[model samples]
Target: PRAAAAEHADQLFAGLQDPALYRFIAEAPPTDVEALRARYTRLATRRSPDGRQAWLNWAIWSFAEEAYVGYVQATVEAGEADIAYVVFQDYWGRGYARKAVAEMMGLLREAHGVAGFRATVDTRNHRSRALLEALGFECVAIHADAEVIHGRSPTRPSIG
Candidate 1:
């Protein structure tokens, strides 16, 4: 079962191909069942340390967008204290993304003492940019390939 989940993770992100999304599960080698088991068990049983570091992936509801309809992934990085996410293609143009992002920000602020966060979105990803804006993130910088967005938590964010 653990092997299967690991395989599924690899297969799932392989299809998406965004490095940000893939980074969450890319190191898992499906053929290494023992390693997969260890990793899977840890993720399955671990609790967020009051939100200092958290990773989540959830399915978006059907009937809102594309056939893949609903899926969301988020991570609050430890050092830089950035939050990032990506949604499935079919789920575009829906409000699910904004809602999920806002919620993740809440989790980061309430549970992790996160004061600020950053994100890098592909330059052409207007949908993602809009979602970030709706969540109160500010467009801070534009890289050659990506636009950077930042949000401040209600309280002072942790440096760690």
Candidate 2:
């Protein structure tokens, strides 16, 4: 639950390179470590205030496995944030994504005063859609290719 750093690039790249994990992601995973390192370097810089977007990222580590598993992130703008997450294929179906996202929401709410969140999921990604729904996010709109889901912290009143 810390900010991403350059040292994490190799493990992150290794976990993300599984093609099965990229099915619904916008871009394919980097083909090599150097490409991943470059991407991570840019991500690290975005933590600065001068960066155009407020990007919060965390590398997920499993204590039992003693390894980095994946990541969860939020792109913030104004009162709301867009959230996304990824877990290595080997760790799929273990409830890790759900737990991580729930924890992330708490951190965002407490630290950044973000009361609401939105997530866009490909229509075919049933697992992700279910995860969001389970976390109290409701599908607000459905485009031809994707669905937009919104959630409010249970401790906060809903916003229209």
Candidate 3:
């Protein structure tokens, strides 16, 4: 995984503009390329490991179609990391998010030695909740309207 770069701004902008992709996400999609570029620029600088946190991000790509699809990220603090992923709506249900997230979990475990992962999913996003459950995450808490799921490396029995 590599840091997000400005070169990816165009495809990233296009992917984020899909309303279906952001339906369950808290933040609405940026309305223009300039906004997307600014966001990407901020993400790029987060690659440097500060004492308080480590931010990792990667652009999702489809080799078969030779295009950028989406992104996956993990923000590590203390001994745990919060993970999230997004794929263009057109690529939804194709297992791209699953593959990317699984690989990220492994990378975070092996490379960073993170003890656990946390993911916040919209309560109504059953698909995302199911994916996390399949990965052995258990819903440990709820905040506002979102469910907070937690998982450890090697995985434990899932809880509701």
> Against the hidden reference, what TM-scores do the models get?
0.56, 0.90, 0.88
List, residue by residue over 109-156, the lDDT tens digit for candidate 2: 888888789999999999999888888899999998799999956763
lDDT of 1 by residue, 1-160 (tens): 0112333443334335444343423233234445544544454433465755555444334453323333444455563356555555444455556666666566657766667778777777677776666666788898786777877553422211
Pairs that collide in candidate 2 are none
Best by TM-score: 2
Model 3 Cα RMSD, Å?
Answer: 3.4
- Per-residue error at 14 for model 2, in Å? 1.7
Report per-prediction Cα RMSD to one decimal: 7.9, 3.7, 3.4
Q: Which regions of candidate 3 deviate over 4 angstroms?
A: 47-50, 155-160
- lDDT-sorted candidate list, best first: 2, 3, 1
| Residue range 1-85, candidate 3, lDDT tens digits | 3457767888788778888977788789888888777877777776544557787888988887688888999998877999999
Off by over 4 Å in 1: 1-80, 154-160
lDDT of 2: 0.83
For candidate 1, report its TM-score.
0.56
Model 2 TM-score, all chains together: 0.90
